[model samples]
Every structure is written in C-alpha cells, then in structure tokens.
Target: MATLTHRRIPGRVRDMPSDFPQVPVQDNETSLDGPREAKAFLYKFSQAVEESDWKSFEGLFAEQCWWKDHLTLTFDKRTIQGRQGISSAWQSLAPQRKPRGFSIAGPGIEMVETPPAFVRMTPQMATLDIPFAFSVSRPDCACVGIAKAIPSASSWKIWVLTTSVVSLKEYPFQPLPRAVTSNDLISPEQRGKATPQGLPHFQEALDAVVIGGGCSGLSNLIMLDSIGANVACFDLGSPGEAWLQRYRSVRLHHPNFMIQLPKYPVPADIASTHLNGAELAQYMSRAVQDLKLPLFAGVKVTSNVFDQERRLWTVSLEEVQSGQTSTVQTRNIIISHGFYFNEDCPVIPEGLKDRGKFSGPVQHTTQFSTTDLYEGKRTVIVGSGNSAHDIAKFLGDNAAVQSVTMLQRSPTAVFDFDTFHPFITALYQGNIPVDTADFLFSQLPLGILRDWMGGAIAELVKSSEKLYSKLEAKGYLIDRKPNFIQRVYEDRVRSIYFDAAGAFDLVLRDRIKIAHGTVVGFTENGLIVKDAETEAERILEADGVVLATGYAKTDLPKQWAKSGFLDAESALQIENMGMPAVDVEGEMIGQVTRSGHPQLYFSGYIFSAARSFSRFVAIQIMADINGQAPEHGLP
Candidate 1:
C-alpha cells in the first residue's frame, strides 16, 4: 500500500512561447464520431494527470468554463493566467502517479447543453466514465474518473477530471448471510452462489442504480442524468407517486409557487399556494411527462452485482406486472431506493408479539386507513403525534368503539396550521422583532421566513368573513391581492413548516383519554403501563394498538453485500450515528470518498446529517442531488 504525495520535478518545463494561446470551447460533436471523441479526450486527460501535464490540461479550458465533479455546487472554474498558475496548482496538489495503462472502459454520455460556436470552438460538455489508478500511490486505491473534454487548437483535450476511489478490501462483491424481510425468512441453502460472477452476463451492469419512486430516487435520477451518465430508475409505483403517496390530509408546508422542478416552472394554477398530495403527484407526473424521463415503473430492482473486470454494475430486477426477472449494466449505480421501502412497523416487544394470541386484533398503523378499523373494538392508539389526534377524533364518532385511548410518552406543543399566502406573511411578520423585519427578511435562509410572513397574511385575508362571504357567493375563494414583496419574499423564504409537535386543541375535550406512562411489558390480556412518577403499574386492555414509534436507518441496498461492493468493515466506514455517511450536499460519503467508486450515490434518511433531521423533503432532496451545496459544505 502506498500513500499519494505531490512531488515537483525541478526545471520540468519545456521552453515554449510565454504568451499563452487562447483556448476554445469544444463543440458537442467535435469529432463527428461520439465514441472516438470520447476516447480521444479521455486518453489525453489521463496522460496529463499521470505526467503532471498541467499546461496541456489547462489549455483545454475555455474562458469562464466550469467543471462539476458531481459533488461541488460550483464547478472548477480554473483560471489559467499564463500556464504558470495551472502548473503550480497541479504540481502542488495532485497525487503522485505512474502510468498503469489507460483505457476508455465505458462509453456513455448525457448531453447537458449545446451552445453555438464560441471562442474558435464549440462550447459543450458531457460526463464520461474512465478507469485508472495512481500507481505511485496505493494500487488498491482505484478510481473511475468522470472527465470533461474541451477543444483547443484544432483538437479535443481533457479539461477537468474528478476521480472517485474504490477499494476491494472496503467494498467487495461477495454475498453475506441473508437478512429476513416481512415476506419470508431465508434458509442457508437458498443463499446459493451470491457473487457477481454467478450472475449471467449483462445481469449486472450499472454504475449507479436507484430502486425507489420517492423523492430520493427521483432526485438521484436527475443528478446522475445531469452528469451525462446512464442510470436506471426502478420503482413499484408510478415515477412520482413516492412523493405523492402521503395521505390526502397532507399538504406541503412550502407554497407550490416557490418549490418547483429544476429549470421547469410549476403550472400557473398549481403554483399559487401550498400543494396537496394529489397536486404533488401531478407535479411529478408532469415532470416525468415533460422530461420524457426514462424509468422502469411497476418494476422493482431487487439486487445487483459489482463487476470488477468490466468495472460495471449489474442489477436484478422483478417486473411486478410481468413477473419476470431482468438486468441492466452500468459502471456506477445509486440506491436511491427510499428508506421507508417497506413500512417499518414497530417491533412488538417479545411479550407483546404473543399478546395478540390472547385477545383482539392487533394491527400496525401501516395497515390503518380509517376510524372504522376501531369502530367496534376497544381502540388504543399508541403515540402522541398527529395520527393520534386524527384517530381519536375519528373513533369518537363511532358507536361500536367503546372508547379511544391515546398513550403518550411525552406531551406535544400544538399550533395553528393553515394554507394561504397572507396568513403565513402575517405570522412571519409577527414572529419578527419590530425593528429587524428588513434585516431578518434579507438574511433568512432561502427567503423562507419571508414567504412564511406572506403566507400568513394571505391566510388572514382569506379567513375574514367579508372575503369568505364573497368567495362563498361565487362558490370558491377568488381573492388575489398582490403584494409587490410576495414574490421576493417567496424567493427568499422557502422553508416548509411541519407540525409534528403542534397542539391538538380540538381533541382536548372528549371521551378520548390520554395516558402518560412506560410499558414494562405485555400480559395475556393487555399492556402493563408503569408510571415512572408514581412508582405504580396499571393494566389496560385494548382491541388494537398502533405503535407510532419512529424509524431506524437501513442499509442502502441489500445487494451491495451479495455483489461484494461493501463488507462489514467498509459498511462501517461510512456511518452517521448508525446511518450511512454523506457529505453536506447529501451525497453518500462512500460514493464521494477519494477512495470510493464513481458508480454510487445515496439518498433518503441517510442524508439526515445534512438537512437537520428532516429526511423526506422532496425539494431539499432535489437540490442536494443536483449538487446545490458546496463540495465541502455551505456557508
């Protein structure tokens, strides 16, 4: 094993004209042949990186040209400033390397943009896959570099090369013991041969493959696509249902007017205010339709393989409608499959798993839909969140259900929740100190606070009797007052409010009851609630219990083990409190480490480290995957 260190060769410069030549941007199809153009650019780029040919690499950069390595928000806008600046930067920073044969292992390009001819060359850029090693450094430290090509002096040249490292010791393609899911438990014999080699050719080919339809997967698809890479997206639902699957009762805390797909604006009618589940679904469906995005919907990517020789990814997929298995290949794969893939129902305690055998029906919240499930039964809802409030209110109206009991381990602070622009505006203004409104509005994150204020105002207006009565006469609310600051506020204030801890005043007075206690264990009839404050235990019987306990992070994709992409040690290499590791931009650290492979990225709750503890926000997820945050972090 060797460690990379930058070394300078004294008097390495070959005498040439001091007045630097003006570089040109390369056209999208410079060579007329895409493969040849791709290979030629990659070869030259490798030569420059290995031999410390800074001048050659820099000569390819067009004025104000930028390079995104997929992690950095702002691309590398390297300023040549007469060759010396270029040479100095590379010589002092790049890892020492010796040529170990260079080759274009894969040929795939996603055309980002095509600018007309500029600066004696066409201005265009695409991301391509190339595999190489730093021989002078660690042999095991292999990397797949995503390089950019530019035109300079009648030839295409490599402009920027961002390398992500991969090591066999850390990530292997071997199968481990299978973990059980709700469907079934595994038998040792079923493990069979779980190696990349066992899969048929083309059975596993992917650089990064994403397997869920939710925000995480959609955003990842856009990011991987942005880099001009061929990534396959698999999900059991329609392309956007993952974000739209929330119960109809849900609405985005942020107004639809501010939150939208990248480069595309939301529909005018839909953009005016908060978005509901159906509206969100329509938005995603529209994106898919508008982009004509490639997707394998109603199909789930079940497993994958890491092909070492081809340096590609192979995934095993089951098409739900067809009941058939197929595979796809690529060099990198992303498991944007969401965290809540399968509903994570709470684990009934050892004592409680059996309590169900003694009495009434025991069901988890995932199976819950209406109050009718508890109508006639002695309904007991465990947890203090919004669901409890809704469930209590629902069951209160049922004649069959004797009573609805809510078990709370802790109390919550409730607040008013509304969905109009003016209401948010007024509230935001109210929350601000009288003298600091202007300053606060200017400095707030994404102008979210300002939007809040505007929305508060809008709500106040809509709720007024005069306005409501007029709208009632017209059969709908039609008040549309424009505040010049509304758009500005929306642009600046983009935060969404979630009322997980808000008050539930409507349910405060009712036959429904609230109990605060700890569960010591379960008995044959019901649960034993022990009061920590009183040193006493109470036995309560219920027809059913809904455990609203939270969730724990799971491994990115189950097949990473079978494919030997990650071993136990390497799995631990990227962890945040037991979750997978990720950079500030929400890119899984394993995929970004200088030693990790380029064919991988991550999403879902694993990104909690970056976004304060909120994981599934679709807009934030989109921004991170699109490389919005700085490579290292945000200011």
Candidate 2:
C-alpha cells in the first residue's frame, strides 16, 4: 500500500527483440563455482543474523532488491521492495521469529528434478540463484527461500529473495506412504452423510466461511482442514453444477495429471486427453465428499456484517430451491468465488445504439446449451474470445446451421494446441512428478518468470506463425501480447485461444467466417456493425446473437459495502483486493492473497494458483484466527 513500483531485471529483456540466446547461460559453466560460493554467501547471511549485525545483514543485499515473504516471518504474502525494507523486516521480525539452520534446499548441482541452484548470464549481468531451506522455530514451521544475486564490489549481492513457510511442524502434510497395504487405506464408517464435522446448516458459529464451493473454495477447505481450522464452503448450486451447467462442449485443456486438487488425484478410470467440464465437476464433488470436506450445497450468501468488536462475520445465507434463510458466524471469510463462474443469466449488454428494434433472439454464452435449438438458424457470435470461438465451432459443425460468423471487436491471439503445448503442457506431461513441476515454477517470482517466459513464448510463436498467417489471410485479425503471463494479469485466465483444431480448423477451412467489426446497432432480423479498422458500416444477417463478450469482474467491495459485509476500516483494508500484483510497467510480479486486512483473505484465484497454493491462503487464515499470524503481521 505504501508504493507501487517496478525494477526491470538486468539482462536480455523479454518483450524486446534480441538475437542472443533467450535462455540465460552462465559465462562459463565449468569454471563457475556457483554452489560453493552461494553456500558461503548463505553462511555469512546466517551468521550476520545470528550475531545481530545489522550492517552486515544490510550489506548482503543489492541496492535495488526484493524480498517476497509468504507466512515465513510475515503471515501475509508481502514483497519488501528495497534493501532498507528488507533490512528493517529482518531487524524487526527475525529475532522474534527465530529462523535458523539455513542450508541449500537440495543436491544443489547434481539434482535435475527439484531445480538445483545455478549461475546464469544475461549478457549484461551474471546472476546466481540459490534455493535454500531453513527452520522457523518460534511457532515451529518449515520454510524455503531463493536468493538471486549479482556480483557487486567483487562479491555476490542478492537482488531478489523469497522466503516461504511450507508447513507447520505440528500439523505436517505428511505424504501417504508410496507402498501401502489395503489396511492403510481403510477407514471407520461415518453416521449420516459423508461430510466433515461442522455446522450442517447455519446452526452454529464457525472459524472460517469460504464462499463459492467450486474448485477454489474446495481447495481452500482442504488446507483449512489440514490446519485443524473449522471451515465450510457455500455454493449457489449443488456440487459440480457450475461445471455441468456449462455448454455441452466444455472441456479443459490443462494436463489431467497436474490439475488435481491437493492430496486428491482425479480417478484413474476417468482419465482422458482433455478433461470434460462435467466429468471434472463430478470428480471434484466426489473428491470433496470422500475427503469429508464440509460443503453447504445449493446455498448462497445474501448479505453479511463484519463485527469489529468480536472480530467475526455474521453471514446471511439462503437455500436456492427452498427459499429458506439462515445466519452463520465466522471469524474469517475467504471469498474464493473463482475466476470463471457460471451465472444464472448472461451479462445483458448495457449500451446498444438501437432501442428494441431487433427481432432476433439474443443469448449470452451462459444461456446457449446446444446447437440443436438453433437448427438451420444463422448465428452471429459477438465476441472473438474463447467462448465465441467455441460457440462458432458448434454452430459451424452442426449440419443444420446455414451459416456462422464471428464478429470481432479486436484482434485475438489464437494458438493451436500443438504449438502452445510445449510451453504449458510439456512441463506437466512427461515423467516429472507433479510436485517437482510445481517446485520448478515456484523457484522464481512471476516478474522474473515473465522475463524468461517471453523467450519460451517467442520460440513457440515461431511454430505458430503459419497458424496466424493463415487466419490473417482469411480476414481474421490477430495480436500477440509480448508475454503470455500478462494475459493472466489482464484476463485472470488465458485469453489467447489455445485453438484445439475443432473451431480453429473450421475457421481456417472457411466453414466458419471471421469478421472484424463491432456491433453498433441492430436490424429487424440482424445486427448493424461498424468496421474497427475502417469507417464502413455493415449488416450481418442472423436469426440469433450469442454474447460471448464475457462478464465483468466481480466488484466485491462495492457489493460488500451495499450489503454491510465489511466496516469502513475493513473495506479500505480490502479495497482493490482481487487481482495479480503487477509492477509499474504492468507486468505481473506476484499473486496477491492479502487484503491489507489479515483475517479477510481473498482467494479468487486462477485455476493453477487456486489448486496449488490454496494451502498458503489457508495457513494465513489459520495464522490470523489462531494468532499464529497477527492482523498487524511482519512487514
């Protein structure tokens, strides 16, 4: 909250044209003693802290540096941005937290899977990245940190340092034994429904209330339960309803092996190349039920008030079908409503130039279930986004439809699955363990990752050039944001169409046409649209229009204010809460889990973050409620 800033990493800048190898390489791999030197640097760092030598500790960092701490010393995921901030944090929180026994995380030079420490070059800078592990003894926790160093004054000076609390010592997330007997998996029988012990309805107060029973909320519940915190999730529909209600052709592109909830792998029997939305929903619901996770199905939060005196929230809930209302109490609230949600109705467009002259049916993507309903009907999809393309594919593939066209307001970045697979899919696919894949990604902060991702994306785009060239030749406009990571910042999900050859093949084959224009007005049986590039106005005849323009971001603060869910102080604490943390240049640096208010955590995250890092969110809430991480936690 103090300042929003940017510090460009020194090297072959991504998003800029460069002939040098995109992969940062050490000047001399054989000559570099990276592991030994990095270990020595870490030793000095530990010694300085142990001796309470503030000057020596300050000297360990570069002038421009960052320290991202995730509940290690600070209960919040905070980025201390400078040497001053870093030194001040260490001075204030170190003695009390008592972090010690620092050592290299793994077999530094020999290991390949766990991402060992190394030295790499950027043409201008030689950087040493060392991943280390340490023990936090005050409350008893296991933590890890990675320090990026550059040689300055003939010594390695760290520029970026990340310290994360992996887990608490008492409530350890022990992995199930690799070789186990049938007796190890057996469990005692439960009484009524298979659900975690908590308020079945709105019968009693709770420690945590997770709104949105989808993956995000469910994942958070798992973590909260692991930490021994009483938590429950609420959804507007029954489990898997959100996914099952999506259009019939909805299928996820993510690798199935990497998409499972924590400690709950998708069943082997239902595995496929692409996970169907309905299948995923069923699996998630079944997983929750089997795990005994508490979920209040078919219920939604109507309103709530945060009690400052009691440090609790009294939430109003209503059953969708029964029209029954109830109140539940909670000390902490996590709004894990997720990035993409299924709404009962589509987003009604507000400002169409014409007033009620169109005779054609207008449907939102949410309302369109099947192409069978529009037999022999001409359809115009209003957006060139992922949903628009999917709808176009369905209409084009259906033999009954006369024609299907996509009216684009702006150029869309589309990459076929084969080309885009290497960057995202390949990482998760091969024999690499899921944890190792995740650990490799967790090694660097997103900002630095963005710098490197541009290179990988650039290489992939070379293979996708033909795909783009052919589309542009067919009148479809295309644009590529420098880094795909920025897409996550702007869209919360991958906005670029990972064209899976169904809709894309149709478009390229001319079965489905693409138009570059905006719908300005409507005709009696069609739409009057304006060309984006030129001032030409045109008419697209259609029997119906599907608004795949997507929905607006949820303004939770406004809704909360209107419904008295938060006080002025807490409202300000969480003001502008949900969104990835970005630098001044608008490059996403990190994902935010804090709202300035420690107890009121926001976990409305992307799919991967929601599934992988929900534990971090849960532990923070646990810290707040149990006083492990205070409201005014470490800086």
Candidate 3:
C-alpha cells in the first residue's frame, strides 16, 4: 500500500484556561509508531482525568475536536464539537460529581491509514452497571471508549472521542462464566447422556423446543445449548433451507460483518467480505453440525397445543416424505419462524380474473425462478423495495428481454451504497471490532438515532444531487422524509434500497422504465395502472407481471390459536403485544409478559440491522427459563 501524506494547514490556537492545571510538554520530535504514541497519550489523559486536572485533559485535544457520548456515560446523547465545547461539556458533566467515579481501563490502540492519522484507541472502562434486575450490580462493569488522534508537530493530538456501554449477557461473543471441559468436545450422544446437575436431560419431553432451522432458529439453538439446557430444534426443511431456496443471484444486502451469526461466525476463508445465499446456507449448515444441536430436519410441525393444567406444550410433528406422525411435549416453546413465513400475492384484478382472458402468466415474486423464463418478452414488476429493484434490473439487463417496467405505488428512499461505505468501514473495519461497533451504534435512543440518520440522509441527498436529479428527470419518485431507518422500523417492509448494484443507474438511463401508479385492474396484454398524479389509467404491454408487493401479515398468533397451539386468550395476548414486543431496554417485551406465560416465547420478529439481535433474544429466553428474568414493568 502506498502511504499518503496529509499537509496540516496552519490554524489559530486557543489559550488554555487560567484555572486549569499545567503539565510539562513531552519531547516534540520523537519517533513513535501509532500504537506507541496512542498508549503514551492515554496514560497522561487517564492520569489527568483521575486527578480532575481539567487543563491537562483539555490540552491533549486539538483546537478543533469532537467528543461523542453514547448512552453509557451520559443518559442523553451528545456530540461536543471543538476543544472549548468539549471542555465545557465535560466540566458540566463531571464524572467525579456523579455517584460513580469513571476510570479508563484496558485500552486497545491501532493505527488508521487515512487522513495521515496514526493512533486510534479503543479502551474498555469499568463503571456501575445499569439498574436492571438481571444486571450484575458490580462496581466494575464493562464499557467502551474510542479515541482518534493524528501526529502533530509537537505530539499526538486527539481529534475524536466516543464512548458507550455494552451488555455482557446480551453480546454472545463475550465469554460466559460456564467452563467447557473435554466432555464438551465429546460426541453428541455422550454429551446428551452427561447432563448438568439442575437441568433436565434430553428426552421425549424437552425443556425447550425451538421451531425453524434457519439463521434465527439456529442462533437460538446455539445459545440454549451453551447453557446446558435440554433443548431441541425442528424445521420444516433442512438448516438454512430458506437461503438455499432464494434466487441464485441473491447476495446479502448488508456486508458479511453485519450478517454474522453469534457464537458461530462465518469462517474467514469463506468470502468474509460478503456472502451469497448458497454460501450463507453452507455456513449455517456447518454451524448446526459443529454445535451438535438436536435438529429434526424434513419434519413439518402439523400442530401445537398448550395444556393449561400441565403447563406444557404438546407439538404434533409429521415426516414430510413418509407422512409419519409423532409428538413431543416441551416446557417452553419458541416460534422462531422468520417474518417471511408466507408469500403474499395480490388477488388478480377483476378484469383479468378469467384465465382465458389473459394470455400471459401472472405470478408472485416468490414464484419467480429465473430470468430465462421471460426471455424475449416484456415484463412488469410491481413494488419499489429492494426485491423489486433487483428484479427490475435483472429483467432490464437480460439480453433476451425486450423491455422492463416497474410499477411503484409511492416514492422510495434510495441512496448509493458508496455514500455510506466510509461510515460502514469505520464501524466494521480497522481497529474497532464489529461487536463493539454494534454495541456503540445501539447505545443511542431510537428517536435520537432517527434524527441523526435523518440529518445524514439530507447530507447524502445533497451530495448526490445530480444523480437524484437524473432519477427525477426519468420519472422516478424519491421520498426523503422519516429517512430509511425510521421507515423500516415504522413499517415492517424494507422501503429503501442500497444501490450497491446498478439498479439506480439502469433506472436513470431508461433501461428500466418507472411507472408511478396503482394497479386498479388488469388487461390481457399487461395490466391497467392508474397514474398517481393525473389519476389517468394506462395500459402497459408485457408478457408477464411479477407481484413484488411484499408479504401479507397472516398474524402468527392468530394462526397458532386456530391450530390449537395456543389458547384463544393467549393468542390474543400475543397479538396485542405488537410486532416483536420490543421494550425500551431493547429486550423483547414478552420475555415474561404480564400474564406470565413462562413456556411461551417469540424470536425472529424484531427488525434490527445487527443480526446479533437474535443472540439477545436467545439470552432473554435462557434467562427466562432459568428464572432469572428481570422483575420489571414493560419498557
């Protein structure tokens, strides 16, 4: 790699406060690497903080620096800009004045290549833990601090600092107290025979039974098995079957680091940067085998019934191939079926209801196999989310396809993936570990985080003004309000697309036509779409129509009730709990609901960027089963 030198422009220097403590300057022209300099700087900085030497602490920062406080040290989020601002903020929010004294501990320092920067220090701190019943009330609780600095003429001057707290139990990568012995390395049969003293052994009646064998379900199984719980997992198909069934071209939208599974991460050799569907399935398969989880594959869960008197769930299972039936009783049941449990295809318009009337075939996005099916023909794709955009681009670029048109009901919030690559790299790459980045990113409150993201979106739109203008010129509608994250959280649907692919460029160049309308009815050739602006109906010519309008909310609780898996009252209780039942503490709302359904739990329902949220769900489930659930009201 070539080294780039950064020229520092001369700037005005602020005078030190008269009351601040003065320290002797270190040697100016010493030769030290980034890590060495960072460690030396932290030593002085920590000493200054411990002694309450505000002047020495303030002197270490550059004239223009930023200090960001996540939810760890401060109850509210803050970004203090400039040396003066940072000094004032720290003075006002002095740690010594608070009930607990703050101290820096276990700092990990690394070098950054860009901006001619040298050291980036990430230190772990010890402080009072959050006042949750499940939390350990230790004086030395773990937290994280990040500091960045550049080599100045005199010495290394700090430029940016950030801090946040981490949950030991929630983060799966963190080591647990349990000791793994040689027996833990034994075969599944031997391990099953040697049970923990308190926990029940694996048998027909299990302590817990998790449904689904995909990423989410597998995550739960890993956590449960780690705690020596006699747990069993069942799925309709094989492990990672959903990913195997996806289109061949489908790669994970997020980077590999973001999609990693807790406890069992994707191996470094297997495309550590990004993973296709098949690759992800392969990783999950290995994880299932390595964990020695009791997984019943190719088994369909026919029904689940809760026995009120026994406080146990009796689940009816059937072998898909042989049609053989069996049953199992478990104390706790976790419905880990993912959000996309069923495909939702809109009813065919009244005009095209008759098969004889329409020549072309109409199908849902799920039924779509490959582009070869629509070769040398025109195709219309409905909706404007990621899937719709991907399908439109695929059809448009196909050599045989005559043309591709996208029918979007409303404007979509689209931004180039490159626009956020720097941010993503900073969070997931370099000195900071992905898990630490995840913890810090989740520290801010939702409302505050949304406001910050909204600002970022505005700046991004301004930066890509010309590209957006081209999109607008080509009749594409863009929505900027609420930002992407807010929209995803509010509506379960993913309404934004990260333009890592060439979909945006295709739309701009008219390779794919964008039609802003709603399908009121359908015609034989294509479909009749009503324009949003003019309210005029137009006929679009196409050989087939793909409905990418997203999945229907079948109400899992209601379906479970109808199947006799849960009582009508319990189902209603879960239904009223809303999607995922997330509380303010970021825990699922009903780990132990007000009704106290101890054996009932849910997973794979929350919308979070960090795939590790599944791990937190598993932790809460384990806590609940072990009678360690926090005794608090719903957040």
Candidate 3 residue pairs that clash: 304-565, 376-400
Better candidate number, 1 or 3, judged by lDDT: 3
Strongest candidate by lDDT: 2
Evaluated at residue 49, the lDDT of candidate 3 is: 63
**lDDT tens digits, residues 1-635, model 3?**
00011211111111111111122333532243444555566677666665767788888787766665432333223445567767666655555222133333332411111112232121221111111111121212234455655445676566556554333234333332234454332235432111111222334566678887777777666666665555677777766667666656676766666666656557877864667777887777776666556666777777777777876778787777677778888777776766433543233444445545557757666777578777877888878887888878778778798788888888888878788566545566525555555654554434335555666678777887778788889888887663454344434545777776679878877889988788876677778888778999998777887777766545666666787756676676553333332333222233222223445655554322324444444444444555544332111
**Full-model lDDT, candidate 3:** 0.56
- Work out the TM-score per prediction: 0.49, 0.84, 0.70
Evaluate all candidate structures by whole-model CA lDDT and list the values in order. 0.42, 0.66, 0.56
- Residues 1-635 of candidate 2 have per-residue lDDT tens digits of 11112222222223322122123444555587778888889999989988889899999998777776666776545556668878888888877788888877654311123433554544444567777888776567877777778776567888878777777776665342122233221122221122223224435567788888777788787777656666677777666676777778888777677677776777888867667878887787777666766677777788657776877788787877777777888887787775334253245555453436776667788888888766777888888878888778878888898888898887777778777766676557746656545655555555566666776677677877877788888888777555566666655443468776378788878889987777877787788888777879888888877888776556545555765656555665563533334544232333334354545666655556665467777665655555555333452
Please list the residue runs of candidate 1 whose C-alpha ends up more than 4 Å from where it truly belongs after superposition: 1-208, 240-251, 257-259, 264-273, 340-350, 356-358, 386-402, 411-414, 418-503, 523-525, 553-598, 605-635
Summarize candidate 1's per-residue lDDT along 382-439 as a digit string, tens digits: 6555555544555665667777777765433222354343433441333422212221
Candidate 3 off by > 4 Å: 1-204, 340-356, 576-596, 605-612, 633-635
lDDT score at residue 577, model 2, on the 0-100 scale: 38
Task: Give each prediction's root-mean-square deviation over alpha carbons.
Answer: 17.9, 5.7, 11.5
On TM-score, the candidate that comes out on top is 2
